[model samples]
Target chain A: MDQFIKINSLKKVFGEGEDEVHAFGPVDISIKSGEFVSVLGPSGCGKSTLMLMMAGLLEPTSGEIYFDDKSVSGPKNDIGIMFQDNTLVPWRTVEGNIKLQLELRNLDISKYKDKIFNILKSVKLEDFAKRYPSELSGGMQQRAAFCQAMIHEPNTILLDEPLGKLDAMTREKIRSDIQNLWMINKPTVIFVTHSIEEAVQLSSRVILISPRPGIVDREINIDLPYPRDLSVKRSNKFFEYVHEIQEVFHEYGVI
Target chain B: MASSKNKLSGFLKWIASGWMLILFFVLFFLFWEYSIPLFDVPRYILPAPTEIVQKGSADIDKLIYYTGVTGLETIIGYAIAIILGLGFGIAISFSSILRRTLYPFFVSIEMTPKIAFAPLFISWFGFGLLPKVIIVVLVCFFPIVLNAILAFNSLSNELTLFHRSTGANPLKTFFKIRLPAAMPQCFVGFKYAAINATVGATIAEFIGSDQGLGFYISIVTGNMRPDLAFAGIFFLTLLGLSLFGFVTLMEKILIPWHISMKRINK
Candidate 1:
């Protein structure tokens, strides 16, 4: 497998002087093309900081990140991101939010209208194309946000705890939707989450990090089959993967 | 039948919301009209509502002309203030050095009573409409600049990050993200500026002007026509309310998606 992204001895330190705080790293990671990887850890473990750095949204205090052999100094057009909060503009409707992707790239809207609508339809939000963010339910808003991220059909996607605040049922539904979308598009994905089950279920490999001066403590390969669903989650093999990750957390005194 | 029922309910809702305000004013006026004579208070001390209305009707044409003049000055001055405030607010937000140097200067100007500058404006622009308009601009500009600064600065980092990650340029991020986010706060500044616009124009007229509701009031009160003075005040209140209502209407049109506006619609 070709290495699509490479992180070398990355580090981040926030503030200056007496108030200086160490956020993460002196760590390294490399992801193969079309691989689904999850960085799983406890809250405030700096998983989000790592994701932001990879997306080129934050400047690293040291080290470097490379995408497709090119050093990333700033945000790139080939990367799409979904934040933990939906962050949908309240003033924009569902369609407008998705269209933001095209607008930002200065793409021809007439050519992409059908493509935009198809993604909305796939997310079951076609009927709500005119509704504002305030009018939609939490799940619907999340779906709209997902569609916005996918509309550009980028080569890579970064998801920062996208389903963290959702209810159990909504989380499961969206999780499956994500799996289906990944299977179809096969974009290189970096998912951040605190839930052990979620990381194990979605990712082919999970990078576990410890909190407070966050660092990669362990890496576990799930070796799960493709086109995963809720049924796969119920298998004994899934339970073993979940248990293995839990034991690492126990080692770090996280649970 | 359904449409008719809907219309009926809408009418009932309108009346239900407004009846108390109407009743309160009617009862207060009645009490004022009856109590003044009962107490044997002199006309100059506190003229009856009826006397004020009669005087107002007698000078209706002149009152309307003066009200029109004041209203025009307020609107023109407010329009100029909005342009300047929004321009300066955006410019300062874009540069940290500008914000650090200019913000304190703006706050100092805002702190000084705008009324104190009335005579200086009169000296520069003379006793015509120019001084009144300048005063209105000075009074109304600060709220817009302050509110706009707050709005621009308070946009969530997550939102900006989302836009940046999408590879949006600074100009696109500004129009699609920053400007829309700043609107609610901008409207707050607009409301304050709208109200202050009236006070500024009136103060300027009072300092020195040949026409306007303020000048008319000064003349009436100086001539001992207390009832006419009350009439001028009534016209001024109308001017203030009309301008305020116009700002609210613009707010509804511009940002119906805002939470406050959405709640009101609901």
Candidate 2:
């Protein structure tokens, strides 16, 4: 498998001298194309900072990030991002908000009409195309946000705990929603999350990080079949993976 | 049939929404109208509602003309303030240097008593419409500009990161994301400026002016014509209310999806 994304000794420090804070890193990660990877850690673990650097949205204090063998020094267009809060523009309807991606990239909207429709239908938000973000429920808003992130079908997606704000039921349902969606394009994904069960349930591999100024402590492969769901989660293998990750967190005194 | 029913319901809703305030004012007016003779109060001191209406109608032409003059000043001044305020807001939002420096300078200016500048403006710009408009702009500009600055800068870090990830050019981000996101807040400034616009215009007229409801009220009160003064006050109240209403209407038209609109509509 070709390494689609390579992070080499990336580090971030917030200030200088007395006020300086080590945010994250001196860490390395290699993700193959179409691989689903989760960077999981406890609160203040700097997982988000690492994700931000990889997406080229933040300047790393040192080291480098390479996407498809090219150095990513700044924001790159071939990436989609989702955050904990669904930041849909309130003035726009769900459809309009989704179309913003196309408009910003100067893509031909007419050509993508059917594609947009299909994505919205896949998320069961087709009936809510005309509703504004403020009008939608928390779950629906996040679903719409998911559609927005996937609309462009970018080569890689970086999600910063996109389901963090949701209730347990909604979180479980969207966990499978994300799996189904990732299968459609098979884009490389680096998901930043705190939930061990969530990381095990979705990503093919989970990269565990130690608490603050986070560094990679371990990487465990799920080696599970595709279309993972509740039934799959009920399996003994799933429980083992979850237990294994829980033990690491417990060892680090993070749980 | 359905259309008529909808219209009837709409009318009923409108009445239902307004009847309480209308009823309260009606009772208040009737009490005032009847209380004058019952209390044997002097007409000049506390004129009956009937006397104010009679006096007001007798000078209807003058009242309307001055109301128009004040209204024009308020609207023009408010419009200019909106333009300048929003422009400054957008500018500061883009540049950190401006946000750090210009923002504090503007805040200091807002902190000073704005009405104190009314006489200074009259001396500099003279008694023409220019001075009054200047006062109105001064009064209306700060709230709008302040709120706009807050609005434009208030975007969340997550959203900013999302914008950056899109690789959107700065201009595209401003227009497509920043500007639209700023509207609900900018309208907050706009509505506040609307209320202040009338006060600014009236203060300017009060300090020194040949025409306007403010000047009219001042002159009539000086002549001991309380009834006519009350009439002028009535016209001024109408001007203020209508200006405020116009702003609210624009807010509804522009951002019907705003939380403020949703609350009010509910």
Candidate 3:
């Protein structure tokens, strides 16, 4: 597969000198187009910082990031992102929130209204376009966040634990929702999660990092097929790989 | 769909308005209307309800005329207040040093009593509408400007980060996001100052002017016509309430998504 996005020797330092904490570092990563990759690690693992650096929201202390063979110095329009908190403006109606992408572009929105409506329908939020974010359930709000991020049809999606805030049932459901959405959109999605099961279920390529100034400890490629569901976890084939991933974690002293 | 919902809401609001507060107004009116009669009081001592109504009807043309003067002053004063308030609010919020440098002086000015300054104003402005308008601006600007600052502060860091990540420049961020976020705050200032501006204008009229509702009240009370004074008082109250309601209406129209409007009636 051709290099769609490449990160070369990325490093991030929080402060200068003695007060400084070395955060992320010297890591190389390349993601192929339309690949579903998950970066899994424990808390304070600097995985999030790496994602931010990749999205051009953060400047690495050193090294380079390139998207489609061009150096990414800052945030570009072609990148989509979803955070843990669904940052929908409470004052805006659901349609207003969805149209924020069009609004930002200063372009005429009449061309994209149908596309936005289709996304709302796909997210099952069509009946809720007139309502505010506060009126929706936690799960629904996250779905709206997802729709807004992917609406612009960006090449890459950085999901920073978008389902982390939800309850178990809602988390599991949104996990499927996101997987299916990615299937349709086919964006190069780099999902960051603490949950190994979640990473296994969704990612075709899982990059596990060691704690504190995280470097890639393991890169496991899952041969799992598409349309994965909760029952897939119960299959013997799934456990075989889960054991292997667990062994990688053990080797990294993360178990 | 909206109108019927509003009507239903209006009816519910009217019922809710009576939810233990209107009884106080009823009691106040009843006591004023009946207490004087029971005590065999003269009009100077206290005006009866019928007498107040009679006095009001007897001087309808004159009362309306003076109401116009006070009402006009109030309106002009309020408009000037809003313009200045919004301008000052935006300015102060955008600049940190300006806020700190001017805050003390602004607070002192807001604190100084209008009644004490009225005679000086009258001496300078000579019973015209300018003095009243100035007072209105003084009273209204502080709350509105302060409210604007409050609105600016209420934006979450997470939300700001989201917009900043989208490659939106500062101007785009301010106009599209921060401005709308501060709008509800602007409405708060609008609501507060609308009523307060009228009060400021009235206070100015009371001490200085020779021809306003304040002047009308003085003449009626001096002539031992407290009922007519009561009528004038009621007119003033209605005017204040109407002005307040107008600001609230603007707020609802501008920001229907505000949490206050979305609240379901109990």
Listed models, DockQ each: 0.75, 0.79, 0.43
Candidate 3, residue B206: how far the Cα is off, in Å = 2.1
Off by over 4 Å in 3: A14-27, A42-46, A209-217, A237-255, B1-24, B37-45, B95-119, B168-175, B218-225, B264-266
The model with the greater TM-score, 1 or 3, is: 1
lDDT of 3: 0.83
Provide the clashing-pair count of each candidate structure.
Answer: 0, 0, 0
Q: In candidate 1, what are the lDDT values of residues B6-87, reduced to their tens digit?
A: 9999999988998999899999999999999999989987899999999889999999999999999999999999999999
lDDT of 2 by residue, B166-257 (tens): 77788999889888789999998998888889999998999989999889999999998999999988988999999899889988898788
Q: Which lDDT tens digits does candidate 2 get at residues A107-166? A: 889988999899999989999999998888899999999899889889899999999989
Best by TM-score: 2
Better of 1 and 3 by lDDT: 1
Candidate 1 residue runs with Cα over 4 Å from true position = B1-9
> Where does the lowest 10-residue lDDT sum fall in candidate 1 chain B?
B160-169
Q: Can you tell me the DockQ of model 3? A: 0.43
Candidate 1: tens digits of C-alpha lDDT, residues A1-107? 89989999999999999999999997899999999999999998899999999888899999999998999898766888998898689999999988877888787
- Sort candidate 2 into its docking category: medium
Chain B vs. true chain B: TM-score per candidate? 0.96, 0.96, 0.87
Candidate 2's displacement at residue B229, Å, is: 0.7
**Root-mean-square deviation of each candidate, in angstroms?**
1.7, 1.5, 3.7
